[model samples]
Target: MSTLTLEVVAIDDGVPGIRTLTLASPDRAVLPSFTPGSHIVIQCADGANAYSLTGETTSPREYVVSVLECPQGRGGSRWIHRDLTIGSVIVAHRPRSAFAPVLRASRHLLIAAGIGITPMVSHLRSARRWGRDVRLLYVHRKGRGAYVDEIATLTDSASFFTDRTAFVSELSLELASQPFGTHVYVCGPSQFIDDVVTAATALGWPPSRIHVEHFGGDLAPGDPFEVELSCSGDVFTVESGVSLLESLTARGHAIPNLCHQGVCGECRVPVRAGSVVHRDLYLSDDERRDSMMACVSRGSGRLELEL
Candidate 1:
């Protein structure tokens, strides 16, 4: 639960509606090191928002993250866009990684779309540093791509597309032709990830070889459910519009959490009974069997938790 006080050393409006923040320590200390595809959760004005680290991972003095203003999001990116500026200080958690490089894979195939390119940049940075075999298939809207220029300097094996249909057709061919040890890493909307995973599975790609980066998404207002604390036998009714974590906190129970979006695995609790509608990106299917992330996941029936 440690935190870092970061000073906004610089801000860039180079991309429309996207602000790139360069953060450094006030006393010029070297920041905590992170691996490729790592993200740090920033305490925003509204709530904590997680952004992928797109800066150097080795002995870096500053950390960089690009925030795209999400109109339909839960107001964290809106706060970063409107209120933050140079010389402003913000609090952030140290980098936590869930999407990391597969060191044993023979080759890395990275796929990204729109703001999903944020995490891929960190992946490419690591591939360049250690001479790892890597390729990127980036799909972005016309003239709205982020880090295209930067990614060009890293690897010439990248492919860019503006047409979704063309990209999917090409991706199907690529997925089928990769070598035996090739692994695919993808980041985008939940549906997009599902489509990519489906296509890969159809192409005989093993589940172990397809990695996904699941981050922010608007949670659906699931059916109302109730959870009982196994410790105290106190039950809390989770309403349609409210999350289980929100309900617990509103009832004066403080749960340690970082990303309200379920990308971080901080608020996961052991499930003692009932079924879980797995919505979090941080948990594996095996891990989801007996545990649930209270941030964005919902349950059915009288869910019992070891909370």
Candidate 2:
């Protein structure tokens, strides 16, 4: 788990509640390459929170992430909004992927709302660079979209909506009319994602062709549980206040992980035996029967994990 020390080289508060920060190495070194829709976990004053990279993947010099001030959140967005300034340094993990663009699809149908458009910004950048077939449906308040002009400039097949009812009515037509092999992607609030997914499902879109990304939210502690590593025969107790990732890492288990809030699927472990209290947003119902995301998921009684 390597980390980069990044400096807030630039800040754009032009957008009302959204602040876009540009981070780069203090020495001007090139950053790691990332796929479209990738994100980096930044260390905030409260804890580590994942933000989607909005810059094109081709950029090697810096990473960009937009923060929407959340007074009701778990303090990460609040700290970024109120405390960070140009030249302020912070630590962050390298970019990791969970919601990458499906390059092989016949067409990409991107639907986003509010700050969910952050990841779609990168997706559209790559699609333009490669000349992929894509369409964007962005919904936001009349004057509050973070990258409205930029998105309109990037693609001609974009539609904007400020009215929820209008968007919902248009969504059905849009979902019903896409050509074959059009993979649908949705990113936004849980209810918004559910709406898109449900509409697509009703329209006969296959589950495999739909992708989703959930933003970091305050994680509530779960009941204490224990997990046993089958090979090592080591049992670790996960406290109510601590996550399994924290519990295991504290005991010297170097588990590969990203987005400890459980949106990214990097830290999933196979469940050999026992019942799992699946809490992650990444895994589907079928996948949950065999695996568990160690980041936010828990187990009841003694559980065996293929660690």
Candidate 3:
């Protein structure tokens, strides 16, 4: 991906623990055009972090992204919250999207949890411009979500849920009430995304009509496992707390990787043998049959890789 040096034009506290950063070309030139649901990989103090673009895409002059400060995270969010400031120059990759809306759909159903509202905000704007019917359901802890007030001003079709029970009940009804040719877009934590998609599918929504974007991997540690390299016949133990990418790298395996969040497909490796417990969204069903993303995925017992 190509990189661009941009300056932080503005920063604002959207909600508790959420900060919105507006970026633009230092020369005040028109930035590259990006569609709704697109995200850019920003180079942070620790590493590159992918964030969805939440600003206007039509004749765009700037890109806006919201970051939820995670105290226990891998340091990217902490860096953004503490070190990044207005006028600070940063390098970011060009915008890319794997979670865009289906423009041809008759109606759009947007469901977001917490900071996941970032992409939905972009989708709402684009839907208004395209004159497409759209409804938004935003779920977050009371007074804890980002962009609540800004999103509230966008559409009257929006509904906010603070209670998990109420949210699930309402979500089921909403999924059941939508008409034919309606597409659903969901973004949030892994469990939330799974719940939404699973409920939609159980209600007969086709996989093609349900789009999802996972914010990040489940940070909870997993069971320990082993991985064997096919090329070198070397074996390495992947601890319960370490990622496969980190494990391989620690053992002198040079692997090409970009975002450690599993959104980018840069760390994909062929699984020559053994079962893989896939945890990434980058691979398709067919791709999962032969390969897995090393950054977030792991093996059940032992995995043989082409490396």
Cα RMSD (angstroms) for every candidate in the order listed:
3.6, 5.2, 3.3
Clashes of each: 0, 0, 0
lDDT of 1 by residue, 202-259 (tens): 9889988988876675445778998999999998789887888899889788888877
Candidate 3 displacement at residue 227 in angstroms = 7.0
Reference-based TM-score of each model: 0.84, 0.80, 0.84
Flag the better candidate by TM-score, 2 or 3: 3
Name the weakest run of 10 consecutive residues (lDDT summed) in model 1. 213-222
Provide the global lDDT of candidate 2 against the true structure. 0.86
Question: How accurate locally, in lDDT, is each candidate?
Answer: 0.88, 0.86, 0.86
Tell me which of candidates 1 and 2 scores higher on lDDT: 1
lDDT for residue 285 in candidate 1, whole number 0-100 = 71
C-alpha-based local distance difference test score of model 3: 0.86
Ranking by TM-score: 1, 3, 2
